[model samples]
Target chain A: MATTAGERESSLWVILLTFAVAMLFSVVSLPEFIPWQLGYLRPQWVELVLIYWIMALPHRVGIFSAWVLGLFVDVLTGSLLGQHGVAFIIVAYIASSLYQRLRMFAVWQQSLIIFVTIGISQLVNFWVENFVGLSQWDMRFLLSALVSAMLWPWVFLVLRHLRRLFNVS
Target chain B: MIGLTLLSIALMVVDHLSDLLDEVRSGLTVVVTPVYIVADYPNRAADLAQQMFTSRDGLQEQVISLEEQLLLMKVKTEKMSALTAENNRLRDLLGSAAKLQDNVLVAELVGVDPDPNKHEVVIDKGTQHDVFVGQPVLDAEGLMGQVIEVSPLTSRVLLISDQSHSVPVQVVRSNLRLIAQGTGVTRQLDLMHVQGTADIKQGDLLVSSGLGNRFPVGYPVGIVTQFKHNPSEPFAKATANPSAMLDRSRYVLLVFTEASLREPVIGAEG
Candidate 1:
C-alpha cells in the first residue's frame, strides 16, 4: 500500500540514515593485526545496502540514487572520482530490473545473484582502475565478491529489520 | 545506465589525469568528515581501553623506560648538533644549498583507507593545521609518506608502501644513490634498477637523498634487508624494510620543509 505523505517523508530519512551507516561501515578499516590483503576479504557494504534499499523500495531508489551514492563512496575511499559510479550504475540497473524475481527467491538463491552481480561490479571497478594502471593485475579481486556473497544473508536480514522498524515502505 | 556510465568515465578521466577535481574532492570532504569521526571510534576505544586497563605499576615502568630512552637520545643529540654544524660548514664551502631545519606538527591517525590495495591513511591535521599536499609524514622511527589530499579537517597520506609510490634514497655507508619503489607490501620497498655492480648490501641504511625535492633531506627511509646480484639479468634486485612502522604507528608527524612553506597561505589555518 502507498503510505501517507508524512510517513513517506519519514521513510526517506530512514532510508538516508541507512545509507549513511552503510557508508560509515564501508570506509572503516579492520584492526592493524588483521591484514585484508588487497581488500580480498573486505565486504562491499555500500553495494549490499544499496541492493537492500532498491529491492525493498524500487520506486524510491533508482539508478540515479546509486550513481550519487557511488560518488560519495569514491570520495570516502579516496579513489579516482567516478570510479565506483560506473559499477553502481550498472549493478543498480540490473538490481532494479530483477528486484521483482529477487523478492521471491530464497536467501541462498538470492546470494548466488549477489555473488554474480558483485563479481560483475568488481570487474567494472577492476577495468576502470586498470585503465589508469592503478590496480594490480590479478584474479584475486574476486575474493571480495565471495566474501560479500557469504555476508549477504545477514546484511539482508538486518537491513530488512531496519526498514520494517522504521515503518519504511 | 549507459549514459550515466559514460558520464562517470568522463569524470574519472578528468580526475585521474588532471587537478580539475581537487577542489571538488576537498569540498565534498565536508560530507565525509563526520562519517570518518564516527568510524574512528573503535580505534579510539581500543586505545582508551589500553590506557584504562594498564596497571599503575605498568604505567610507571613505561614512564621509567621512556625517561631512560630520553636520556640516551639527549646524549646522541649533543654529538649530532656538532656534526650538523660541521656538515653545514662543509656544504657552504662547497657552495651547496644548506639543509633547512624542518618544522613538524603532530597529527593523530583518524582513519585508514578502506581499500587494502591502496596504502593510504587519514590524519587529523588538515588545511586547518597548515597541512598541505606533498608534505612528508614521519612516525617516531622514520619516513612514512606524503600528504596527497587535504580536507578542511583531515588529510590523506599515501604511505611509502603504496604500489604507486617511490622515493629517491641514498646509501649512507657507500653514498650510492638509488630509487626505492613500493612493492605493494607492508613496510617493504624495492630499490629499482640496481646496476649489476652496485655496492648494496644487507643492513645498509637508506636515507632520503632529497633529489626530487619531495621529501626532506637526510631522513631515514629504509634499510637494506635483502640483496642479490644476478649475472644474467641486466639489473640486480634489492629489497628494504621501511624505517617507519608502516602498518602500526597511529601517531604521525607532518613535516613543513622550507619549500612547502614558501607557498602563500591561500586562506585560514595560518
Candidate 2:
C-alpha cells in the first residue's frame, strides 16, 4: 500500500479540500438548512472528518494540526478560545496511535470506536465549559456524541471514496 | 500533545480573565466572516427569490397598508413631541438634565452561534459603522443584547439569553429591582435574589433599571411568565419571557447611548 511521490503530492490538496468542507459544515447553522429540531442532533462533522483522515493517513495529519483546526472551530463557534483545541488534540493523538488497528476493523467496530472518541471529546468540552461557568450541566450535552457515532459509517465511506478517487495516500 | 494542552489552557485562562485577546479574536473574525456569509447564502438566496416572485398586486397591497400605518405613527409622534417637551420642562424644574436621545443604527443578523449551549449572533455592522463593544442592541419589540466583539465588517453580540449574561431590571408595577440572569433558554430569563414574599407575580413587566449604567433605564426587558414560591426556601424563583423575539428577529438596533459613549477606558493592568 505504499504511495508514489505523485500520489503523496496530490493527497495534500485533497486533504485540505476535505478539511475545508468539513469545517464549513461544522459551523454552518444546519437548522436553517433543515428542520429546526434536527439542529440539536447535528453530528460533529469536523471531528468525524478528522477521525477519518487520522485513521486513513496518520502520518500526514496528526495531533498538532488537529489542535490548530480545533482552535479555528472554537473561534468560529464563539466558544472559549481553547476549549475545542484541547479536546481535538486528545482525539487526534488516540486516533493516530491506533490507526493501524483502526483501519482493519469492520465499519460497525470502527463506529464503536468513534463513539468512544467523540464521547471523550464531548466530555472534555463539557468539563471545560462548566469549569469556566460558560454552560450548565445537562444530560443533553452527550446527544451530539451519539449522533456523531451514528453518522460515522456514511462519513467514512464518503471520505474513503474521495481518497480513492483522488488516489490520496 | 502536552505542550498543546498547556498552551490551550493558558489561552482559556487569559481569555476568561482579561480583554487582552479580544483584539486578536476580532482580527481573526475578519478571516471567518466570509465563511459565515457563505454559510448564510442559502437563506439569503431564498429570501431574494421569494421577493422576486411576489405578485405585483400583493406588493401594492403591502405598500398601502404600510402607508396607512406610517400615517398613524406620524400622528402619534406629533403628540409625543409635545409630551416630551413638557416632560423636559418638568425635569429642568427639578434641577435635572434633559433625557438624552439615543442615536441608533440598524443592523441585520447575519449568522447565529451554532453551539446550542451558548447564545450569540453575528451582526452585519462593525467598527466601520462605529459599532463597538458594550453597545446595547435592541429589536423592534424590546432590548436584546450587547456587542461583545467587533471586527472590521462585522461584530459579535452576546445575547441576553446567553447563560453568562445578566441585566438589572425593575418591575413596572412595584418598582422592585432584581437582576435577570439568562437561563440558556432562548425564551426565558431568571430573576435572582427575590424573596419568597416579594411582590413579583405572573404577568409583571420587567424593565431595565439602569443600575449598572450598562443598559439604559426604562427599556422593556421581559414579562414574568412563571412564578414559584416555597415558604421553606429563602428565595423565590421566577422566570420571565424576554420581550424581544430572540429566536426569530432578523433586524436589530444598535443604540448609541451617552453612558456607553462616556464609559471609562480599561486600564492596561486590567
Top candidate (lDDT):
1
Off by over 4 Å in 2: A1-11, A30-38, B262-270
Kindly report which residue stretches of model 1 are placed more than 4 angstroms away from their true locations once superposed.
B263-270
Deviation from truth (RMSD, Å), model 1: 2.7
Q: Count the backbone clashes (under 3 Å) in each candidate.
A: 0, 0
* Per-residue lDDT of candidate 1, residues B1-270 (tens digit): 888988999999999889999999998887888998999999889989999999999999999999999999989887887887888788889998745456678889888887667889998888877788899999989999999999888999999999999999999999999999988898689999999788889999999998888998888999999899889898888999999998889899888776775543333110
Give one digit per residue, the lDDT tens place, for model 2 in A56-97: 878789999899888878878887788999999989988998
Name the 10 consecutive residues with the lowest summed lDDT in model 1 chain A: A31-40
Cand. 1 TM to true fold: 0.95
Local accuracy of candidate 2 as per-residue lDDT tens digits, B26-80:
8777877778888778678888998999999999999999999999988988787
- Where does candidate 2 clash, by residue pair? none
Per-model TM values vs. the true structure: 0.95, 0.91
Model 1, position A52, has a per-residue lDDT of 86
- Find the 10 residues in a row with the least total lDDT in model 1 chain B: B261-270
Measured with DockQ on alpha carbons, how good is candidate 1? Answer: 0.78
Looking at model 2, what is the TM-score of chain A? 0.90
